[model samples]
Target: MKRALPLLIFMAISGAVFSQENPIGIFEDNKDIGNPKLAGSASYDETSQTYTIKGAGYNIWGQRDEHRYLYSKVKGDFVATANFEFEGNKEIHRKIGWMARASENDNSVMVGGFLHGDGLMAGQWRERKGADMQNPEDDVWAQKRYQQIIQLERRGNTFIVRAAHPGEPLQEISSKQLEFMPEAVLLGVVIGSHDENVIETARVWNARIDQPVAEDYNPGKDGWIGCRMETMNVFDGKRRVIHEKDGRFEAPNWMPDGKELLFNEDGSLYTIPINGGKTEKLNTGSADDLNNDHCISFDGKMLGISHNDGEGSNVFYLPLDGGEPKSVTQQAPSYLHGWAPNNKEVVYVAQRGENKVYDIYRKPIKGGKEVKLTDNKKWDHADGCEYSPDGKYIYYNGSKNGGTMQIWRMKPDGTEKEQITFDQYNNWFPHISPDGKWIAFISFSPDIELNSHPSYKKVMLRLMPTSGGAPKVIAHLYGGQGTINVNSWSPDSKHIAFVSNSKKSVKVD
Candidate 1:
């Protein structure tokens, strides 16, 4: 009996930690043990990627009564995040945050990192089954404030909670140990109305769930997992995932008519509805090996493609509606980036000299000798080069004086070279919006090498005024390479489209 007891305990712990039955997507609202009269509603916004929970419950503490829960059943270590807030003025105790619990029971063993309407944020929990919840161990309490970014991470047997205001990273607030809770538990966005008769809905935005991965995991051999095609309302801070797939897709460019989005998958180009639907193959005739570096001209009448399947990249021009592609650049390793204001000339980055230096070059659409715009002494690497909207300047990214890559711009005539951004992080692809009011670019962390922007790393999409100013983070995502290789700003200049990756582990249902 003694030997058998130890074996039984080990098996029980193993089952809790490594269960494969996980629901790995957005979920609506459901009650644990609440009054049938107290209703709750939940929804996920496909445009802004926000979640809302309209819940009515007395309280989630003090042995529990009624509340709404929207959760995913995850078994292994994971990180969950949300921007949490209440709809309007309400009672001080109205709560909404993130939770991890063993079950939906009213008195289930659980821990919650929640924010109260009265401006109190806490890490509350129940020690035993059906036990009354204890006070949180938060170091400080606010009288009334909303935590815009809330994160809950499970590291082995310990759970850590953190929250911060918008445009800021989550900072640690509290940590708890719940060794008794099952390893396979429900954890996600949570909300409680506090007053069962009056449902003060809770709002959450940028809901993300990242599963644990090895430090050296390879996406090619391990295979890519979940990918979401997302759009962002740059002005209002709203984002949503419109389409999700099991593998990889790259660089979505808004269609000319604004009815669809064109992206690259495998080695071909495809178009899906602007919002999301069945994707149709955009036949490029013989240009089957198109890369993500493709874009439409200002007049929206022509398309440029960079085909890099065989030896080196070949730049081609074709009709916007897809037709027989005509070769544009005579060089072997040229990439198409931008078109002149009148659509009469095309600009790209290519190797022109015996040094194999990557520099900006321009060629007339009606057939002319290629003109090199940038003539520097060293640094064989310069990329993300493109022409400004009005054709006044050419924006590109490269390191100067052997420093970090900075956003630089020069006159279309290749004179008056100047730097735009000077920061510690390596920035790339200074894409100008339609109205020419803002510049959206991708930034990699300082820890990474200056010349590398690898895939599946934590990266940020930052926006700055085109004239130049402080950059603000518009989106924090787990994507690189295919996220935004080309200009994807909508025609109205209100939104931008990009791609983010994830390793989804979904339940079979």
Candidate 2:
């Protein structure tokens, strides 16, 4: 009996330790805050990359609170986001969202963006430890509801909350400056049931933590941030991360066969299975100074690249299976962006003569007079030129006299130019899908310069009908420049591959 008792005690201790271990997604630990009458639990499902949190608490209001928290310590500025959906039982006041707290104590000072069971979206906070929670009445909380995704960001001592529905742009809900908050604090997802006796369950997914770079940070002079390779379903707006790297990688090009994706890292091209496995470097032979401006031919038999030639970039082509690259353009500074449907010619952006203005041009691969497609002299700028699937139009980003950049399409000869996007944001790189029904593009915030698409910035991947309509946001991520510089749509036109950045490095696998 003594031996059995000792074994039982050991098992209980082991179970408790296992519960505290942090093996799930991005969290460091999972535990209940305030110790509710009924214990709370948190779990992660690897298959779906989803988090399920069941919590019992009287409420996350008034002095002292109870909830389940899956958290890690973060210092300085950071942004956290998650999509939440409550399940089973419901109470109007039950809450689920992203949180930043001063400590683990139930009455600690905290601020968060939350969604209530009855479709209430708000930013709630406690200014001081052991103080009652303050929401709409004390601040500018969102009155309208039905938002399922919540984001919380901290800059210095100020915290802001933003919420949005799937496939929509996030709208600011509220902001608060907590002067007493420390530089380092607990940041994670939290769940609470308004009634202590009732346990509420909620599923959370697409949780992300990103740390923004300084205003003057330079990716080339400074260093690059971690990269996340992701593919998203165009119809349902669901994203699946295929791989992550601690350093820089950019501009994923979906192979025509749809079995793998190719991207550039450290001036070398590499390929990885779409589902992510071993990363194999593509043989570029002597042409290794490649940039993000690389794409696969429509027929899937050729690869086009922009390699740095001493002073500037030049277009080159090689077999998709990798071999010695053959020069396509003698002009330095020429960047390959698209290939003609005939496969005998390629489209690029370059400067010629005394104009010195970057414009779209088409040249035969076998050597011929390069035909200029855009005449954006004066102060106008043009780049990211690509041909539509049927070769009916050439899509590109352009600005008139240093104005806001927007997607524009023109005929093969650069005639009948027409603006396709009318948003205030700066849109760049319009990639037409394989089916020619949809156009995917990246948009930078309106605050950014009209002619600049810098790296390590807040951007959105948006989708719109090729025929034209309002564009809907598919993904909001911290990336720019190399995020989607080339055509990345799967052969079926159902998914797209792109890269996002984060300060926190993730597991390579």
TM-score (C-alpha) between model 1 and the true structure: 0.83
Residue-level lDDT tens digits of model 1 in 342-376:
89888888876686567788888778888888874
The regions of model 1 sitting more than 4 angstroms off are: 1-25, 33-50, 56-66, 105-112, 121-144, 154-164, 167-183, 194-198, 351-357, 375-381, 503-505
- Report the C-alpha displacement of residue 456, candidate 1, in angstroms: 1.9
RMSD of 1: 7.8
Best by lDDT: 2
Question: What is the C-alpha local distance difference test score of candidate 1?
Answer: 0.74
RMSD of each: 7.8, 8.8
Using all chains and alpha carbons, the TM-scores for the candidates as numbered come to 0.83, 0.94
- Top TM-score: which candidate number? 2
